[model samples]
Each structure stands twice: as C-alpha cells, then as structure tokens.
Target: TEMFESDNVDLKKQMQTYNGLDHPFSIGDELLVENSQFLLKMKTDMPNVVVFTFNDTSSWKSDMNIYKAHSGFTLEAQNLPNDINLLGKDAPSILQKDQAFYSRTTYQIIEKLL
Candidate 1:
C-alpha cells in the first residue's frame, strides 16, 4: 500500500466553522477562507480517499455555533471511478493491496472575492 502526504503551512494552527442542515456541505463544496491549509490523502483507491482541514470559514449567516466551527478536519473514504486504471491492468484488486500502501496529496483553500 503505497502512501502519499502533503501539508499547508499558514493553515497549521487555525479555526473553521460550517453551517447548514444535518447534511451540511456536499462532496464538492469549494470551501473558502482567508489563509488555510489542507491535507489530502489518497489510499489504495485514489478516488476513494480525501483528507482536508478547514480553518476560519464559518459565519453567522446560517445556524450552528462556535464549537462546530472552531477547528475541524475530515478524513473521508469514497469509491473510485470504474474507468480509472491505476494499476496497469495486471495489478490485483484494491482490497488485495497491503493496508500500509497508500498515496496522498495536500492543498490550500482561499476565499476568492467575486
């Protein structure tokens, strides 16, 4: 199980807040903030893994509270697309790969003034 990792500097120590219904934001919400860092990881299945940190992105325009917005991150596992051929065809099933073998990537989220 190959592994990959990345980090954001300015976002190391910050806070984030989100609001909405029980479901909140969807998979691709395009989060925004002043200066924040995110850490994304790609496990056995590249598409199935997502890791990110949100800092200082909440507002009173909606519901929720400070506790919910104060420092939050997520490590989500999803399903990879069927068309993606990561292993050159000869590779074994994703389940067969060792748990330690994983890949990751990191990025940052910035608020764009529209």
Candidate 2:
C-alpha cells in the first residue's frame, strides 16, 4: 500500500501480516498479498479512505446492509442533472460558473463489465 502524505511526500509501504500499517491512509492502502484476508477498522474520522474497484461488489454479496454500515456513501455511476434558470442580466456569466462547478462534481466511473 502507498500513502500520499499531506506534505506532498509519497510513502510506499507493503505489509505481510497484522504488524503492518496502523496509521490511517488513503485509497485502499492495505496488504498487497494475494489470497489474504484482512479486517480494516477506521479509528479516526480525519482520514479519508477511497476504494474503487472495477467490479460491482454489491451485486455478488447477498447481504449489502452489513457492508453499507462500513462505508459513508457507495455511489454508483450516475449523473445528477440540475437545471438552474437565472432571470437576470448576469445569467450568462453565472451559467458559465455553474457549468464549471458541475464539471468538477462529475467523475468517470470505470466498470469492468462495462
């Protein structure tokens, strides 16, 4: 697993057993060994861990309610369309700014099956 530090330093540390990384990290940073099972517990709220797999994890799992409790929000590939009408002379400029914000919110979700 690799950690992108707040101070712009990238630390790559791979763990084999339970005596690995203890501190909170980002982006599914865990043991990279194959056929290994590990339990992850989020001790603090400051760290943001993002795990994005190409597979649809919810479909194969029979009970998703248990997994839902672990994650904050499991969002699928979707487009949140918002239509805002500005009834003023500054409509054009505001629309431009709004488009930029909308674009920022959007992210391309790559699915393995798709």
- Which segments of candidate 1 are over 4 A away from where they belong? 1-47, 59-64, 68-70, 80-114
**Candidate 2 — what's its lDDT?**
0.29
Q: Which candidate is the best by lDDT?
A: 1
Tens digit of per-residue lDDT, candidate 1, span 41-99? 22333344344444335544555554543255554444333423755554433454466
Residue 93 lDDT, candidate 2, scale 0-100: 26
Worst 10 residues of 1 by lDDT: 14-23
TM-score of each: 0.24, 0.16
What local distance difference test score does each model get? 0.37, 0.29
Write model 2 residue lDDT over 52-75, tens digit each, in one string. Answer: 222223655575445432233222
Residue 90 Cα positional deviation in candidate 1, in Å, after optimal superposition:
18
